[model samples]
Target: MPALPSFATFYPLNHHHSQGACQCGSPILSQFHERMMADISRRQFIGGAAGVMAMFAGLRAPRVLSQQPSDHNRPILLKNLRLFDGSGGPLREGVAIRIEDGRIQALLANGADSGNAEVVDCGGRVVMPGLIDAHWHTTLAGISQFEAMTADPGYVHLVAAKEAERTLMRGVTSVRDVGGPSFALKRAIDQGIVNGPRVFPAGAMISQTSGHGDFRMRHEVPRSADSPLSEQEKQGVAVIADGEAEVLRRTREQLMLGASQIKLMAGGGVASTYDPLDSTQFTERELRAAVDAAEDWGTYVAVHVYTPRGIQRSLRAGVKSIEHGQLADKESVRMMAGEGAWWSLQPFLQDEDSNVYPDAERQESQRMVAEGTVRAYEMAQHFDVKTAWGTDILFSPRNTQNQLRHLAKLTRFYDSLTTLAMATGRNGELLAMSGLRSTYQGKLGIIEPDALADLLVVDGSPEQGLDFLNDPKANLRLIMKGGRVYKNTL
Candidate 1:
């Protein structure tokens, strides 16, 4: 009977031995190719099954509701509900959850446990992980004020308290505070003295003297018909370090200050007043020095880069990730991928109201910084680059909410669930956090036997249609972060 399992009969063997090599076990082209072939096959099948015609809006609602049961969370049990497990897959229905001590004890089929409990009854709402904003600016005062407070601990901590409120209320549970605003805020959040997102902070940015983060400007003041960095121009945020020795020292300094990671201005910026976006500000030695320090400190360095030369420099220097990447040419994009450095994309969508600030005032030299950002996003997508969402919020009034809404835009048509995974399981992975995998201390993003009870309940089934997330302030019925209900319309 077992004449021997054929090679084709074993899916794993076939995928590995015949298909191709991929870091992820799946065949590199399998998904794209499979979808293409399926589309063709469906077209042929549709012609034969001709009676199937179009339906009106909300056609999927009946299917969704039929599976939902009222009074589901009897003892905090999520009633009949749809589930997105955050593993880059489609949604499931009729799932029930049991939560206690802020930990998710179990995830099972609808009515899996009818035992007596104080269930909230999901009523079949959509449940997924709490959001994570990696590139949040916790210390926001305004672009005009950041430089002045670089050494002012009091001002930095004060700003942190205010932004913390803005971040958590909008559903961002965890944040990676990269560059500026200091690490004290992250520490305070961990200590519970402040109420805000869980922070993974990079104390202050490290940069070359003339680089984009460098706040220094040339002395030739007045008006410049041709020159950009006039002598009278203000200093950039980048710390001016001339040689490799100074760069190395600075990197260590950043680590000693409690940097979970490092942010280096490897190139110029589109927004910095001191340097142009295309300028190759840091040399390889300077960058390598920082990388060396980061390696020694057991952390990664995120480089703010926008030029081909600068990209190459950071890549060779072993910067762990590329931020912005707006001006990166084809070769640079390839180079970033080749090095396996992650791309932290900031999807900051600016309306005319946001970009009204003129050059040298609210300050960025370009007519608008939005163009380069959008272009970078397109290229990053084209190359299939592994990306994480970043806010780069700065001191904007919308605060961190702008970034959360931007994620809704990325999957406007379909698969918005992937964005949630990028914000959670994947983000934790990027930071080399293993035990916390798929968990908010065992409750939030992932479904497991023992996980936290931090869950979100939205109005519609996300898989059927994603417009539900389009309105963050609209139609959300329940939100439980760390088993504490901040919002519940149920």
Candidate 2:
């Protein structure tokens, strides 16, 4: 392998203008300069870079949340709760949780004294770790296929903001956005400028030419040095890169932009017009390039794949997560289990509203993948593979509204407890696979001391009735994320 170039050289920081001014042209450099001038801390600089990138991309700039950390530092105490600690088991009764500085300080026994914290009487309400979606697309939220293809960039960001708030209010505290431009949204939420889940962004989906990430219209020519990029690429949602070198460079770009993980299109997909559902996309070498780049940054590559051939190639290339393995065979599933890679599966219902593809062929491919959902789950379970649930709800605003309902669909394969765990604890584990590239520190998806304070208080025990998750707005009495109360209806 060739020596990898530094990120600064890969993405030049300075652009010399005709007037002889050496201006820091890129968003990354401008953010770095601003941080230096403002004397911002390292953590704030990292998050502010994302907000700067969003501003450069034509979206409204997000306010930096570092200056107001005190706003979220207030101590909180919940008394008399039935706790589901995100570990699979019966709920513990009459427990109390004490939160301070955005971390859980203690899990006290019933009737514990609250000290100076703001106490809320739970009245035996069920408290659990906030929900997590291992696979999500924050940039694509609340937009239909038609709108995504034609909507203005500003309008799309506005829609994404609204969707982020909705996702949080529904009890989901975190999401690993597998594809799309989510860096801005992630920064906004982290800074408290937006009410939303913690986001682990995969800046853009890297794809082989004509692969799943290729949202080019039929009339548009294939991407080349002289040709302009597609709108999606321009928006930082996805990029078309081929071969080892290009793939490596694109992966590095996303890593530089603060991607927790890299998403690669390793196979054909239903929504893309050019690729067949069963066809493998990227070559093994190309996949390896992506993995190598991600590993260099202490993260991993996750591939969008559905078929056995694609799965086998990605697994062999050291991909850490496999998305949409609906068409994966038993052998591929076993291989994934042997490697301990995650199967980020989505429960696709045939009766549900699907992405509106331009042509009949694309729609047919969508149905084919949807029909294979059951077989994929069965294979994963048979092999005891690590599984995570997500509502890969894309390009359909109506379907996006059913994010929790999609998690509920997991009950078809596993029991209610197991299903709930998949969405919370197991998904949290998957997000942590980003390793050092992860943004937020401390444990998530569990009600334990030293864990990040993302809790949801439900009116009833979701362990016994997972359906309570389906109607989170009604059943959720309180929602706290990172020690800040976003909703309290008790």
Candidate 3:
């Protein structure tokens, strides 16, 4: 074969130089370049480029929880419990649940024989489904903004790991991770490398430039056309995309990365600085691009929006879930009911558990959201809109310890039973909107035959009040997820 062509001859010097092609100014350098190029054939170079492209395109196999053989085959019997069932129904007593293969095999009648299984006596405690937080930020809930923006990605992930275990110990066994770089944490939990809840991940919060998901500093604005993606975007914390084409591309990227659902920033947010509370972000066409991309992947889109205009735009774009609609008006609430969309509301009561913002404007915005939250709930109830509950705790490690308290705040709006059901079954139903994109395959948020075995055995009745949840270490006598006992005090 003819000698391999010189780098400058095969490609223009400027183009090759910019791409890190060999620059041989001396005879020795030229010989070294020739030897290196001869060792790596054109086929090898093309194959290497294809592998890099594949990595960037996210074409790797999805990381799902590999079933542990021991857990998969072992049968477990949980006896002597009052079943809350998570169906908004009265608790049923004297039932024992049979669990196998990470699911409830059967609900045995009183005194039924349990053969060859480990029996756990719950001592007449109230057994309920593990909690589901529909709008959680798994990786961001426990870290400060300064740390998240400036810390190493590995350190942030370690913080998230500790927080995940805390969340699980608090009796929240499943969470719909609305934003953040949680894929690694989620994989760790699934593989039993870390103890945590089931994660329904939306890889990143997709936003238009200057939108709610945009976390760039003011000085970082006026981004050059050819500038690289920001650090946060590269880390999967958030992505800033513009226009229909860019939105479509960004949404697909998340889907390719194993996002169970897509999260779009369609309106202003208190956590973000530049966007006003009343301002809408993505246009209907741009929102539709994301929706269409998610829909094609057998999943749905949930939008971060609050104002009526933003809510309406998202709904028209086929968004299935509306997150943070605390400022929604009556017409918007009615539209949500008409469209049968999910209202993923948080109890933004401006209480001790609320997110802390340094500036007065954001504080005022928080107060406004809190003021509208009660009315928003009332309207949702009146219109019979489907509602799911979450505690969007952010940026405070201390506030994360109050997860149960934030959940109990829902009792101020509804009775304890309704509140419990909202956090359990209702939120699970909302998570099911992910369809085929869901990572876990069994049922969640209910104590029924064949439901996934995520359970909490409480010492007292939650029907009267959720105060017991405020003390998980004491009152939550037993906690089980995927048929494996994580905590047992009974």
Candidate 4:
């Protein structure tokens, strides 16, 4: 029989598993087994393993592509199209857009100019800004909670990468990732290693002990001052920080890690076991500390809260965005409007996309949120608050397919035009609140002169209602991001 390989060959020493390095039972291990059977010396096998590890590391690192050079001097003109422009204005016809160097060079009349530019006849389709999701969770959206907690980080990231492509195919070209370890995914997407949205990443969700983001088990709690951070925190999913000083430190840490905005758990959540839905978390001072730290970095803080008191406390702390205020009363809505805060609301009406909770209490919490969702929308509109739309799909890869369906649900409350504008234009405005820390520099969410070239060619018009959006594969004929065409069936 062939000599069995050492255990070290199966589990490489010094491998950063937390950063998603390959492990035993992965394809790499199969290769290792094959090589060992080939009777290679242990030293040679170890050297090959090291090479494989180096290759995986390179995949994680950002690379500047010579093929995708920045200087795209040659322009691409998209002609013969109707435009939505993402401004919620009437659609314009008989216009062409000039794209170059990942930005819109100008808007021109049909057959206006020809300077050796490549021409793409859009066949009179409706060209509009790509959709933006204001409250996405990049790493957590596609996997179940059990998998997210138990699976290897590398495996989880692989799942996320696959889901990212699906998300882009849905015509959602940009997303504000509110939580989870999305730094690697963002980097991969930006470097062109993966095809996905332009991610505005908030590195991790910060929560007080037993608060919304606290994912620790009961046995792991009741700790000392210097307890090792929970597995979730170590993986950059969520960190439990108490008091003002710790809150400030954690906030700054995320900012240092390239957080475009900070996300603080300002209240209890239905998903968390220990926290009640009605409970408010984080003192005003603690919330303020995070806000101050984020503001110092020229960005802002968005809080996760639903209860009236929680919303009020977050508003008082200078939070710029409220992730979920479905349970907010009229007073809270009025306060949000007065403060000019962005209300990132979702359609959580116990629909097919709703997350399934195991217990009755959590189910009740979900029901309460669903009940308040309609009222919340009414209040936001009544108060003229700056409301944005997002599908907060979490822990269910199957439900991600309903992303466009979630957007379509908005039509129940508003007109088709208003729904499209909210998902595209208004959400873009909310993303701009990230300020200087924003990853993509050019203006997004509008098809205007000099805006970033993130657009889609839709086969239907808003007059047909947003029902066409429900089936993106058949409706979205072309998709472009950063002047690069990712999908073009036409």
Candidate 5:
């Protein structure tokens, strides 16, 4: 007879088990088998055995690209680039940038050595920080107001996801979503389940009854504590809170849900049917309540106000950002500058499609707001008020797709470099005003040592002419966010 196979070879047991299991039918072998079986659950033992077999058979687990870590830890050296560091000055030529571990490690002069890193020749292309949108509505992107009010939430979210991807591909790596159901989307992007920009979600825009955030139809009654919340309020896109107490509670609720900041309708809006553009919405006490709540949570409040009185009241209540100050006068602009508040202005093109309102009064209100855009920009600049640029593309799928075009329109008021700086460096500074409540850390919107690696390598210099931004697909040669390359045509 052939020699009996050893227990180690037959069963592939460890040394201790092998010593006592030479004979299969022996008492020692039986006891060893029982003990080994007891040491591991049946399911685990089976799975482990199968895995070992698969390994021996040259089988491997399927790879999930999104779940896998990105090239964040890898070192990359971009050489021979015209670097626009977002410092509001001339671009540096023949510079090299080294990125490692999701941060800019160094900026080198011409012919400087970068050892053992993956080198990319930029071919004298323009390198700048990824753009930032100070104000955006992520969940409302690509959806008309009517569609948003009538469409299913699932369908709306799908559309928002597609738009988010489009926004990122256009070189906008970060956005401050002032209103919408952005918390879930932000998590999805951060977890690598989706590809999009880093979102600073404001949770919901807190408004007074019939204010800008109230999307209720005419038949719908004013919201009360006893009444069921509207779909928009329930989804955390907007909340209608009436007195000071309600305002404080709603603001706190938003903060509880991870709102980076608070948004309040301090004045009437052009799109809202019940309020005139000049009508003040929230009372001073109510506005102060929201501001207090946000401040307690280490954040600040941004208010939608176009009129001088509305802007002045919000400023007195400690609102840090004043959005849509189109109807503001020079005195109001000076007051905003004195208060050190940011004027988040949108350049509404006169020839663009106007916002549709069922009420004739609301349509007139829209036109009035549109007519004040130029004056708003000029006044803000004249007063030396800190200003941030945003598209404010709400309720129009067509307009949402033209985000970069809207940014380019700022060139009418500023030079190309100044316009670019507003969208990148200046806007980034304003976004960080949330302080401890900010979602992202590390400096952004600039290509400097220790800043987050959100960069764009454009085919042409935007500082020379912002026309390159109009066609991002062809002009944006490379896009990298957090050291992960999203687009690389080169």
Candidate 6:
């Protein structure tokens, strides 16, 4: 076996992925090295290389979120675009984007040019930051929505890879997977084992039994209540505990399992049948335990809540964000705002010809499908919440594309421009990332110099109407992520 690079040369964080390589010398060590380089983000790369690369700014960036072009040095120019920077701002017409080192080098105005770069004429089409959905769930089961809630990690990760591509087609280049079985699936996506969104995944969802992710049926598990899931089942996918101390242990356990963030079910969910959406299960101690554990680990916790009581406890715990607040009242919204936690809403439960269900289940779900979403939207808008686009696009027994039309319609909550930000810039901020608007560095959500090179060019400007963006069949002229052209035919 070849001698692999030193650990300090590779990462500063000691992000040891023992499952694969990172061992001093193993067979196929080069394969592990290749994956280590490909799998790591600029941030992770810097962490491993902290001492060696500290003199270089990008290598030692404090936030590790700087948009300084570090990939390659030459400039690549794009011309003739109508640009939306995703700051709830107006679009710029006839603009040009300059990129280098896989970062936006600059965004020139309509006739603006730096004069020393290669250019591709966009033919007056719209250019925007690649879309990003902050609250997406990739580990789901069934050939359709009706099949069931699960499959194995390998099966689901493979399935998720396909969904990730579909999202890119819709102009979304990055996504934050809210929860999954473990870090394995997210590691697969991030390491380029599969091609899809730039995934920031929260491995395994933490839950108290009867909370949102508790899948245990009393009749099924005859083992002790304290038996942790088998090695076959991990904390990353579906972990359930009972009391506060137990939940607290699971919280720390997940961080050890390669999680960069934490996810807790504060209450019930529409999908999980046991707990009512309004019931708040976690005590203040449990909430504090999760929050403290996450704080100690250098990450944030995103709580899943659908009702007021659940929302209240989540606030007490100081979670960073809330997902699918289908029944939050105005006070809860205001409280969330005061607490500085953002909201991620999926006003996308509706679509034409996209229904799936057993006859009776479908009929019962219809009532929930309609009322819960409508209320969620109304509260988000009324409270002036930091609500952004988080279409929980589930593709299994159901087509993910069908639900998007509602997101388009929901754009009426804010102006069309702000709505686009929900899908791009605002969503980036919700992910707790920095530098999304045009002027900042380490950009993720816009097209400009020194920004990430994720872009979507379409025939019609989505700002013209939600329909232009929502139509799955809409004419997308090109899709690029990190300067790689994944799709080009219009």
What TM-score against the true fold does each predicted structure earn?
0.70, 0.83, 0.84, 0.86, 0.83, 0.76
TM value for model 6: 0.76
Over 85-196, each residue of candidate 5 has an lDDT whose tens digit, in order, gives 9767899897899988889999987688778677778888999999998877675556654554455333545666667788898899998877654777787677775678
- For model 1, residues 55-121, the per-residue Cα lDDT tens digits are 0111111111112223444435777778766565777787787766566767767867657756677
Leading candidate by TM-score: 4
Error of 4 at 49 (Å): 10
Work out candidate 6's RMSD over C-alphas: 11.1
* Clashing pairs for predicted structure model 3, backbone only: none
**Cα shift from native, residue 367, model 3 (Å):** 1.7
Model 1 residue runs over 4 Å out of place are 1-76, 100-102, 114-118, 141-159, 216-240, 348-353, 359-369, 399-401, 412-415, 433-445, 449-454, 464-467
lDDT of 2 by residue, 1-490 (tens): 2332221211111111000010111122222323322432342355555433343354343432222223454588899888888887778886789999889999887778888787878887888899998877675556654564454434556677777888888889998887756776787677766678899988778988777766565567644588876544554656889889999989998998888999988877654446766779899999999998898888999988878999999999999999878888889999999999999887765555444445676557656776778788988899999999877665457766677888777778888878888877788888888888887988889889999999988886666667777677788888888887778777
Which lDDT tens digits does candidate 4 get at residues 1-490? 3353332222211100000000111123222223333433444466665533432343342232112322356788889999999988889998999998889999999887857677878999999999999877675567764565455534655677777888988999999888755776787788887778999988768989877776666677697987887545654656789999999989998898789999988876665557777889999999999999999999999988889999999999999899878899999999999999999888878876665556786678778888888899888889999999888776667778778888888888888888899988888898888888998987889888788999999988796699888899889988888988777777
> What local distance difference test score does each model get?
0.55, 0.73, 0.75, 0.76, 0.72, 0.58
lDDT of 3 by residue, 1-490 (tens): 3343322111100000000000001122122223333434453465654422332232122322222223446798889888998888899987899988789999998589989877778888898999998877776567765565455433545676778888998899999888755776677688887789999988767888877666665566689889877654654656888999999999998888789999888887664456777889898999999999999999999988889999999999899999878889999999999999999888877766665556797678778888888899899999999999887766567778878877787888889999999999988898888888998987899888889999988987888998887887788877889988877777
Q: Whose lDDT is higher: candidate 3's or candidate 6's?
A: 3
Residue pairs in collision within model 2: none
Better of 5 and 6 by lDDT: 5
Which scores better on lDDT, 1 or 5?
Answer: 5
Best by lDDT: 4
Instruction: Give me the runs in candidate 5 sitting further than 4 Å from their true place.
Output: 1-72, 145-152, 222-225, 353-360
Tell me how far candidate 4 lies from the true structure as C-alpha RMSD in angstroms. 8.0
Q: Residue 45: error of model 2 in Å?
A: 30
State each model's C-alpha RMSD to the native: 21.6, 9.9, 11.5, 8.0, 18.2, 11.1
Clash number for candidate 2:
0
